[model samples]
Target: MAEPLEIGSLQIRNVSKIFGTFKAVSDVSLNVQKGEFLTLLGPSGSGKTTLLMMLAGFLDVSEGDIALDGASIAGVPAEKRNFGMVFQGYALFPHMNVRDNIGYALSVRNRAVAEIEACVDEMLDLVQLQQFADRKPGQLSGGQQQRVALARALCFAPPVLLLDEPLGALDKKLRVEVQEQLKVIHRRIGTTFIYVTHDQEEALSMSDRIVIMRDGAIEQVGTPKELYERPKNKFTASFLGKSNFIHHNDKVYALRPEKIDLIVGVDHQDARMNGTVSSITYFGSMQRVIVDTKEGQKIEIDIDVWRNANEVKLGDAVDLLWADEAAVELQMG
Candidate 1:
């Protein structure tokens, strides 16, 4: 009859939401394990937000039910669910100082003053915002304010944390920095995190598992390596990571740029894919070579250009070689 510090099995079964004729989410189901970082990944308008809203109890499911730890929470209210949620914008209280902002949720429940102070202090330290505890949201940097917002969400010790593009507003460098901090915090707390993001790099970096969604349905779900190496289809291959899909009659192989290597005269050795180098772009760290193969095939290969890759040039002949096992043959219409 006691709740585990973190009870994180969320089973969303056959959930759907419709805005008249169009279905925002259609009969989607997912199982999130205890203390796991799961990302709901998709482009905009792909029903990820709708699904999250349903889980948060902000939006009702037009059908089906949601259960946490084996109990159905179909009609439960948001406040009762006690979920820690952060949106794209750092939704901090503009009027409150950082300390008060971090303590807001606990205050709403009228937790004891001393307990609130201790929890708030712990959260501020968790997010490294202890020095800025007295500053208002407007005075702190975007990253700092988001950190405070994250602290606030966790201050309540919610069972699960929901992040909807939580790092979307920060600049690139700050985003990367905060992502590191977030991973550390997640490890320290060991809570279930359901993060939603369209950033492929972010998803690949932060999540313990990724759920790729398309057209109100799940395209694929797996760890980063699994998704990248064994994408079920061309769409998932291209969506989760950089992939050059070799269109085949019965199957499709999603090959990554790094998997390609140049063999000056080995085309005939392995299937013989003859191609003319259409363009070569020298990226300081790598070179991207686009080859137009015989039979109108467009193949892209990324070669490390530190010094060796400078050897490649446009209009040059190249024989590409990859192990027969490297190619991920796929079938797509």
Candidate 2:
């Protein structure tokens, strides 16, 4: 078992970052619980990285304070804050072997030789990299180098770990494998994890809670299911997953493609609309059906591959039905 590290809550109080007249992050306040896996998710230029840099003490806050366990750490230097960071590029020294790379943090702090060795061993085991301990970084693959970076960051047993798209460098298959290992490592060590990613699928799959940012402000924050099923605004609805917006009674409502069903005959459904099938695209297990409705809206529906063009032809009139509860009312400004 690895040594248990102290973890605590982090509070960001009305934080903002400014580069000249433009606000990179605007009046953001959030609370992160101890040992929780919180993700900051957004598209490019959404200020997620700026916010993370402020939290890491690498960038000064333009307004408000950052507190760790009720004490302010905004004025502290990045190195003195006792936090670990892993970047997307896997910033490992090329000359150092795996064991030396993992032990560098401890050595910098002047820890005893025996203590550093023990900690390096524990970290190598934690990341399943013991066999590659003697190999230099140049000899390892991308995935292996990333694992080494993670082990190096965690070997010091920091209270919090900040990852800036650490898995973005790997291929799809290796990325998925590393993602599973990351979850396992987090569960085993119970450290507070703050991850930043633009990939919606990754955020949905890995985060305990997700904060979505847009134009330097938070659009919404919730669990994956909450964000997917009930979005507070149209941007949140569309960004988190596929959504079809319907204007009803001068109000905008969002419905997911999977929630809307296609009807051939008069079947019981809460709400129904008539439209012509504009297009059909095939996926392995599912098919995407696009329909042009009489209401001047193009609706997209996802159905099982078992029900395809054999039953519904292009330009054929069909009924799109869904439950009233399936439509989520949105507050669009």
Candidate 3:
């Protein structure tokens, strides 16, 4: 069995990236724990990719420093950082077969030919691509090609692995399959993984901790459940998932769509509002109901399809009920 990596934590302190007049990343400080899967999540122009590039030693920092363990690696070259990078495009060499592609990194380091072959074989097995060892990139499917890329990146067992939207190119079903594979691989190798993506579900499902960024600055950082259930601000609440903002007692509060319950009869709870069923969208297993309240506020309720016993219809009057603790007060930004 291959030994798990002794990966050390990464410390990024007051890091910034500048492109002429544009500040792509600004004053970001974060700690990525050892052997943890940390994801940097944000929308376009949010500077997530730029930050990952700095971590990979591909981009020069405009200010501040990045250190692995206790040593500063701010001036280290990309090749000298000993980090593996997997890009969205899966940049595999078409001329090389799977075995050769996976073995390329070891060969470049001038390892013995037998050792390179053994490591390549181990990587192929790790990614479950052993059968396709002789197939070139042109002969493999997109997912298979990506596996080859991942295998190549891991053949030398780098301390850290960086992925920038590595599964973004695949279709939804294929993307999900690859995600499972990635999680499995991470567990087996126990290396530090810093992934970058804008997909909320992806970050929620895969990350040990997620760092949300906006406009080149850090917005919030927390575990997926914490970020989803107790977001720090309006931007995080709305961006991480669907949220309903309601004004009550002259204060704005955020509530999750799934937390609101809809009742067909008269309202009894103090936190109840009367609304018309404006729309209902049926997803498999669950459904979303949008209601236009009499107070001129729109509310959304998400419930299991089977639990929607009221069978509400469009134009029907309904009561939207939620507990007091379900509503999280938001700070105006």
Candidate 4:
């Protein structure tokens, strides 16, 4: 078993990547602990990929330096950086067998044949693809090919692993399966994983910490629960998860649909927003009720079937109230 990481530090200072006139990444600085699973999450054109590329030494910083374990690696080349990369597509050679593909890096470095064989087998075992050692990329399933790509990346035992939406091409069910596999591999190997993805659910499920970016800047960085329970702003709240933005005076409160529980309360004790249930949508395990309140506020509430069966009806007058603590504080920009 791998020992707990004595996590070296990663620091970036004033890193900017400007493409022509537009700023792809602008003066971004961030620190990540070694062996920490940190994900750079954002929508397209949010500079998350540019930041990852810079970290991998693929693109020039265009401004600042990046340090690993107190040493600057700014002048490093992509090959010399020793960072394993799993790109959006599984870039495996169609003609190469699984073992050969896994051992390709070791072979390029002129490692001994026996050593290369051992490393390849170990990586194959690591990804649970030992049985298909002789299979080529085309002969393997999509998930299998993905595992082979992961094994190839991990075979070299690099200090850092960079994933660029590695599972984006797979179907939803396969994506979930791969997510579990990747998390387990990270735990087993104890390597630093810097995952980049636009999928909020993916980031929330797999990462220890998520950096939410927008327009080439860091919007917020926190744990999944932190971002979900107490977001820093309206954008962070809305981006991280589902939010019901309630405009209250100068500040807007973000009340999560799951958090608005149904309850009976007196006029003074209960804060009620009188509304008519305009429509309802059946969403398998739960139901979504659209309620239009007196103050022209449309509140969308989700309730589990077992809990709120026939409790509220369409065009029926209902009182909607959320706990004061349940409404998280956020600023709407």
lDDT of each: 0.86, 0.90, 0.90, 0.86
> Candidate 2 lDDT, tens digit per residue, 1-333?
265656658999999999999999999999999889999999989999999998888999999999998899999999898788888798899999999999999999999999999999999888888999999999999999999999998888888899999999999999999999999999999999999999998999999999999988899999999999999998999889899999889999999998888876433354378788999888878888999988888999998877554587788888888888999999976
Q: Write the per-residue lDDT of candidate 4 for residues 203-265, one digit (tens) a residue.
A: 999999999999999989988888889998888888887888887777888898887754332
By summed lDDT, the worst window of 10 consecutive residues in model 4 runs over 262-271
TM-score of each: 0.95, 0.96, 0.97, 0.95
Q: Where does candidate 1 stray beyond 4 Å?
A: 1-4, 265-268, 307-309
Ranking by TM-score: 3, 2, 1, 4
TM-score of 1: 0.95
lDDT of 3 by residue, 56-154 (tens): 998999999999986899999999998888987999999999999999998999999999988988898888998999999999999999899899888
Which 10-residue window of candidate 3 scores lowest in summed lDDT? 263-272
Predicted structure 3: clash tally: 0
Which is superior by TM-score, 1 or 3? 3
Error of 4 at 73 (Å): 1.3
- Model 3: lDDT to the true structure: 0.90
